[model samples]
Target: MTEKEKMLAGLPYQAWDDELVILRENAKLLCHQFNHLAPNETAKRHTILSNLLNIKGQFHIEANFFCDYGENIYVGDNFYSNHNLVILDVCQVSFGNNVMLGPNVMIATASHPLDPVARRATEFGKPISIGNDVWIGGNVSVLAGVSIGDNSVIGAGSVVTKDITGNGVYAGNPCKFIKSI
Candidate 1:
């Protein structure tokens, strides 16, 4: 299968070493479009300057956002991000309706293998899914293969390394459930 096909399938693949070069080139073109628009263009340009990857009914964004591929990331209606939202969407990053993200929040779906030697040669990405009405606080980092369940809240500056099943508050460096709501 083609490399893009493998990526779409969520299968492991090598980054082809030149991925960043291609991304840089594409980013320049996309940025130019973003910069030159008159504030109503759709279908490639961002919905709002402050808000990057918004679907209909999604709201504000305060800081910069970097996405590997914008089309692979989909946000549901009424989504809101505060600031510094970065998504390394090597795979699909889907958000349900009414999701809120605070400052410095990162949602990553890319990860290297555990072994250092293997890490250099391979890249793996699992889809990151966020259910409806979830709230992620400032400075939080979400790792690969995670799903934040519906109605859950992630505390400030927490690093989420695993799945959270919903209806609770999660915190800490590795992000553990603190209480259920």
Candidate 2:
């Protein structure tokens, strides 16, 4: 299978493969262009994002947004992400409509093998999915293979390690449900 196919399938693959490297380079270039635009260049910024990610409908993403393989990330309508948002989209990372992410939030789909020998040779990835009407607080880290259910709120400085299936407020490191929202 191709490197991209391996990545999407959550199988081990060389991240530095020529094809993957090229895709990352192109995404970096587009992100650079989007990040350096004038404040008034809204139309151009949208155009750049149009070329970079699968952004559907409307979104107001702040500057300094970083991602790997932007094409693997998808954002639905009415999305708003604060500054310094990073998405490591080695696999697919999808955010549903009305999703909002606070500053310094990271959604990472990339993962390294625990085996030292295997880690150097190949990397794998898992998908991250955020349901509609979700709000992820500042400094939160959403790890690989996680899904936050609809209308849930992730408190600031939290690290999400597992899937949250029910709607509620979650907080703390390795975030746990605080209370139902």
Candidate 3:
């Protein structure tokens, strides 16, 4: 299998492979263009995002948005994200409909090997799934392989490292359930 195939399959693969590098570069360039556009240039921004990600229906993302391999990221209908949203989508990072993200939210699907020797040689990633009607507060970091179920609210400044079931309020580092909504 090709390096990209391996990467998508959650298998270890050389991140610096030519194909991967080119894809990342393209995504970066598009992100740069998207980020630098005038605030009132809604049509242009929509055009760029349409080319970059797999977005469904209505969506709006504020400035300073960045991602790796935009094709691996997907956002559903009625999605909105505040400024400085960074998604390191080495593998699939999918969002369900009616999701909102606060400023400085980082959703990452990329990870390195624990073994030092193997870490330097190859990188791997797992997928992240966010269910519908979820609201993630500011400065939240959702790590790889996490799933946040529908109708949940993640409090500000939380670091989510595990799956969160739906219809609850969760907060704090390593995000624990607070109360059912």
Looking at model 2, report the run of 10 residues with the lowest lDDT sum: 164-173
Q: For candidate 2, lDDT tens digit of each residue in 64-122?
A: 88888899999999999999989999999999999999999999999999999999899
Q: After superposition, how far is residue 87 of candidate 3 from its true place, in Å?
A: 0.4
The C-alpha local distance difference test score for the whole of candidate 3 amounts to 0.97
Across 60-172, the per-residue lDDT of candidate 1 in tens digits comes to 54435556666567888888887567888778899999999998899888887889988888777888999999999999999888999999999998999999999999999
Looking at model 1, the pairs that clash are 57-78
- Report how far off residue 97 is in candidate 1 (Å): 0.9
Off by over 4 Å in 2: none
Which segments of model 3 are wrong by more than 4 Å?
Answer: none
lDDT per residue, candidate 3, 1-181, as tens digits?
A: 9999999999999999999999999999999999999999999999999999999999999998999989998999999999999999999999999999999999999999999999989999999999999999999999999999999999999999999998999999989999999
Q: Report clash pairs, candidate 3.
A: none
Model 1, runs deviating above 4 Å: 17-24, 27-54
**What TM-score, to 2 decimals, does candidate 2 have?**
0.98
Which candidate has the highest TM-score of all? 3
